[model samples]
Target: MGRTVRVKSFELVAKDINDVDVKLLHALSIGVGWPHRPKDWDFLRRAGHGIVAVDGIGRVFGSAMWFPYGHEFATIGLVITSPRTQAQGTGRWLMEQVFERCGDRNLTLNSTHAAYHLYLSLGFTKEATVYQWQGEAVSPPPPVPALTAELSSLSTANIGEIAALDERAFGANRQKLLALLSEGAAISVLRRGGEAVGFSMKREFGRGHVIGPIVASNDCDAIHLTAVHLRDLAGQFVRVDTREQTGPFADFLQQSRLGINDTVSTMSKGKRFLNRKENEPWVYGLAGHALS
Candidate 1:
């Protein structure tokens, strides 16, 4: 007699932008190295883009998120699968749903070695390598006096200024996405003489936090702002995903005793215009893999 295998019914749902639990499950699966967490779910849904896959019983088995930069491009991340259901194609199914939702829009993601083959099989090509730096607590660095623009939290009143500074640092306008920062997450900005010079935004993922798009006019200001933000987090482990060109920020992570947890390949499938360079002093970290 042949062994019997259960055929689970899979249903993919477009998550409500306000569905917090689903978002938390997605975050927990990726950040805390777990499939899902009950407590944080509500918080995650309110943070950003989220999608979920449920079984016949209505229990979520997998989830993913896409952080949109513009209608033309989005980064996908927070892909997770329940351990009991591994090798059952839950992950692939979830990714397929994400691709379908993305539909002809340019998509990008950072893949770990464990998931590289999976992404390659899905038509993603390697674009750039990103190193993760883990560091020890050090005395908070002093703010750059020359760049001494007082940094402030992003708000509706100052969003236009934030958008303009982002364009100057990132080489493109991301006003649409930057505008979303005022909604739920913490967005910090640096101002000197009442003019914005730099800014950073953060979102909650499970128990940890991810900070990025840390745009600044120079390395010193970037470092200062980052240190301040990290200090605010105190005991929590935070992930700062930055581009290779961001100078002392990466070095600071190294010198501070932060470990380089892993290096991910920033892969893409379609057009490629963003190339890594040494001269670009400003460093920008993606909010997450899905939104990069």
Candidate 2:
């Protein structure tokens, strides 16, 4: 079933995203200057549910997706409208569709500059700014701070080992999303006294590898967790989206050659999505801008 929406002269139909061809979705994202590869789109399709705005001829004009972590919480992302249709109400219509489907769940999303006003007008409050950092991983990535924990490789088979810690940092039990992200991803975990303290995952995304979902109790540990992967990715493209605007962890990323590329505002429609506490686990890096 689909609903027809008039955006200017064209009548766009909201179709189930799963039914649309992946190539069409890729083209839609490309038209908006996003870096989501077709494979990345496919992975996201598997991670959540979405809808695509299509026309009578089957050309997609927009898309929106929501990842529900549990019965009462969800993160909305991947919302895009064709540049040609910008400001004609297509984006608003698409968000309305997402709202109808998401029901009463507490919602959050990282809004791009173009969509900030639209989201704010719809009742989303700004939470924080996420900094997108990326560059060729430098050789011998800035010296690590004094050794305080053991860093080791983590296999997906033992994903449960860090579930509790990740939930603590992210404010939800995203074990399922972590499991999906774990596939083909290089994982590293920081352990102290034989107990897992923090972890990070490096995976193929967009134009290069993204190291993220980095969880730690402090800036030093977060740096070590991220550096463990950066060291292995020397000379390769790496990206990390973090909310830490200023701190030792942010400084370390700059020293590692990951320059700030862009920023997005984290907005929530219900309960606050981010909750950081002293000496408590925090997300040093995000899994992805949309996935956050």
Candidate 3:
């Protein structure tokens, strides 16, 4: 939609997304070879806001979704345009609507290379590079059986700790979104000296299980938390999106046979995107770009 050209007289109009419209959004993702399922989109919509472009017949041409992690920080994702509507202003128009809701909040997004220039034009600067790793999930025996952190499957009692650690690592409170994403999903917690220090979550996504929103005190605990949830997922396809701040986790995933799939530019348009302290635990893997 960067160019000034418009697709034929389709009479497109923008409107707030409704609960009944996730199917159309799902179609937009698959239209471009992405495997976002409607069920996952529905989960996001429970705590997110979105917009859709439509014509006189009410057919969807484009869609965009955003989650306001807090008053000062937010993230957007699942932006899709129907193949037939490229460069027709559908993507631009829908984004304008979503941005209005963001107001002064810092905005972050993981963008495809094709959309990188578009984001640059809109005031976002590159913050980091996110790599997507995925392949058949394999349960390889750990090189060292004694993982440093004591691993445990998350229970309802662990939600408070998980949410607090997530808030610190993510730079904002995503308690509601986390609750929805973790419901009935595999959650693993890392404890050191009988205290929760890190966690990882996995849920049904795309072709198989996707893990993310992982927070840890260090690389060792991060890999251990990931390994705990991934234990029984062998042979099932799995995916994780992560910034390359740690080479060991990426190396570990590769060692487990989850090959690097694609890379995206993680960009932000805001001030103070993250508040950090000396030696604070960092986010090891994102919930997914869409929800990040």
State the lDDT of candidate 2 residue by residue for 218-238, as single tens digits: 999999889888888899999
Off by over 4 Å in 2: none
lDDT of 1 by residue, 1-292 (tens): 1111233544434344344344546553655374234534443344447666554455555677775555676677767666655677666766777777787877778887777888999999887877765443444533333545686676666678777666655445667666654555677877778877677876565446666768775666777667766767655666676655346666655544455666788887676625544434254665545445
| Candidate 3 Cα deviation (angstroms), residue 26 | 1.9
Question: Residue 142 in candidate 1 has what lDDT?
Answer: 32
Cand. 2 TM to true fold: 0.98
Q: Is candidate 2 or candidate 3 better by lDDT?
A: 2
Q: What is the lDDT of residue 90 in candidate 2?
A: 84
RMSD of each: 5.3, 1.2, 2.7
Ranked by lDDT from best down, the candidates are 2, 3, 1
Model 3: CA > 4 A from native: 1-6, 141-145, 272-278
| TM-score of predicted structure 1 | 0.73
List the global CA lDDT of all models: 0.62, 0.92, 0.78
Q: What is the lDDT of residue 13 in candidate 2?
A: 92
